[model samples]
Target: MDVTKKKVLNGYHVIFLVQNVMIGMSLLSLNNSLSAVGYSQWWFPILFGIIANITLIPMVWLSLQYKDDDLFDIHEKLLGKWIGKFLNTFLIIYAVVLFSAIIQHYLDLIQISVLPERKITGHLILFILLTVFIVKGGIKSLARFCILTFFLMGWIVYFLRWGIMYGEVSHLLPLFNFSSSEFWEAFRNGYNSMIGYEFLMFFFPYIIHPQKAFKHASIGIWITILFYLSVTIVGAMYFSEWQLENLFFPILKLFQAVDLTFVERIDTFGITIWVFLILTTAGAYLWMAKKGIDSVREKNSNYHIYAVAIFTYIIINLPFTQVMKETLYEKDFYVSYGLILWPTVLCIVHLVRWKKKEVV
Candidate 1:
């Protein structure tokens, strides 16, 4: 594929791509994670958005330094062939695992709520196939799909009105009562919900207007932060502290509070519509993993996408206990945190080298 032709993402695509990827399965459990801070946890999303934007600085700076290169190219430039290739391999695996974990979480929900008797393998195969199809269309297709995804499921916010109406307003009054330790604990727990934006490094080269990409991406982050804040506030207000801590999917409970004349299973409907968001998230990561493969090979091909989809499917269906799956899922956050911060180190190294050359 021609490199120039492949760079198809515009500013709006950049905006929605970040937004859709960030709003994934993690939102269902985010309030539970933030329960450590009590009512004040509503502010965590804002804090997270601010922090995400700040970290995005080095990522954007690094990408702009080499406008035609992705993260892998920048890694190789900064660290040379052997070491950069090794680290890129680690990143590819990380992307694959991240994809598998998202698919695994959603499939688990399907088994528990939608199909108790069906084999998880069946669902896993179907979902991975769909992901592969989306990725086959390339990142531009995925970005356009994200625009559709934003509209398809964005109405979910209106459902929060029920939760807000039923919830105790007094619970929201004490905004900053939590101790620093408690706030840190909550931030640690819920920060994973904000991990998807770190992908900006890989996709930056695809943006048509690289200079304005940061503003578009920032809009996406704050948009997601608003959604997270709305849901977290509603969850904090409606659920007791114990309930907020114990409930696995607080968003589902919020939907349950919706009393619709025609639909008794609105929560199920919400879960169904949520598949769009899941596909958008997993598709982006899967695409990134494929791109990593191309980076390693120095060629662009869709075959790697299929191979990765198959690998991820097998990993998802491995005969591991639920405990093991959850453990693996939890471990991805550590990798994500490291990946988000790694570009800062790269940016510093690049600057030091530039200064040394100037001095010489």
Candidate 2:
């Protein structure tokens, strides 16, 4: 269908899509994840941002090579059909698992914090329906939704001022205090927050200004980095080392610092609003998974979206043990990290093919 010709996503869409996707469930617990470095964790998002930008270069470079082809199509062209399809199967699985993981994690948090008395089944069903609706509209629709989510949810950052006002500035001192092992531990644990930027590989074909995409996407990333940095710095300043280490979602604790008259339980309010971020993140993955299914079957159909959504629903609802679920959702991020780096391998393949063509 030459989907690239239908590119409707502008630079702002690219920016917001990159930003919102990276801002999902992870932000809530990001401080906890980076607790290995103690107070020094405030700058970790910057480190993550730097790594994300470096990795971003290869992805954008590869996408520029085939302006009309997404990562799935690029795989087929570069590696040949059978091998590419084999690799794409794993990509599809990665997308589905990631979509399921983000949804499950958010729903679980809601159960713990807001709807503890209620079973998550209702929440799960509602979330899937909303996600399916967003993905069904396709990438342009999803991009618009991402833009809306960014504006709507971006205001919540203002609430962090309460924590900043009350927190001690001295907590940010003793910089670089962590050992080398601790830095590595913090990096490993917190890198998941940076995962969404890689989806740029999947959507690059739809960008209206592909050349400016790197600039726009970089802006989006730094915006998220600044947001994360603000929250982490406030968290470091506001909480004790024990709280930073033990509180599962320190941002929620930061939320408790809000002493407003009209708003009671602002944390719960924040969690409720978080559904928008979750929707955009899951919607992007679901859309990519649907595209993967279409590429595999060599047909375009709305049913692909539904099929992936159903599969995601079942995967999340499965009665796996807590440990098993954690392993699948948390530990399986190696697939995402691999996807981020996969473009470098493809770039090498591209150069070889170019040389061979020249020799011919």
Show how many residue pairs clash in every candidate, following the order shown. Answer: 0, 0
Top candidate when judged by TM-score against the true structure: 2
Worst 10 residues of 1 by lDDT: 1-10
Local distance difference test, candidate 2: 0.90
In order, the Cα lDDT scores of the candidates are 0.88, 0.90
Clashing pairs in 1: none
lDDT of 2 by residue, 1-360 (tens): 223337878999999999999888989999999999999999899889999999999999999999999999999999999999998888899899999989989998999999988998888989999998888777989988998998888888898888889999999998899999999999988998898999998889889889998999999999999999998999999988899899999999889889999999999999999999999999989988988988999988888888998898889878889789989987567788888888999999999999999999
Clashing pairs in 2: none
Off by over 4 Å in 2: 1-5
How well is each residue in 150-269 modelled by candidate 1, as lDDT tens digits? 998888899999998899988887889888998888888899899889888888888889998789999999999999999998888899998888888988978998998999998899
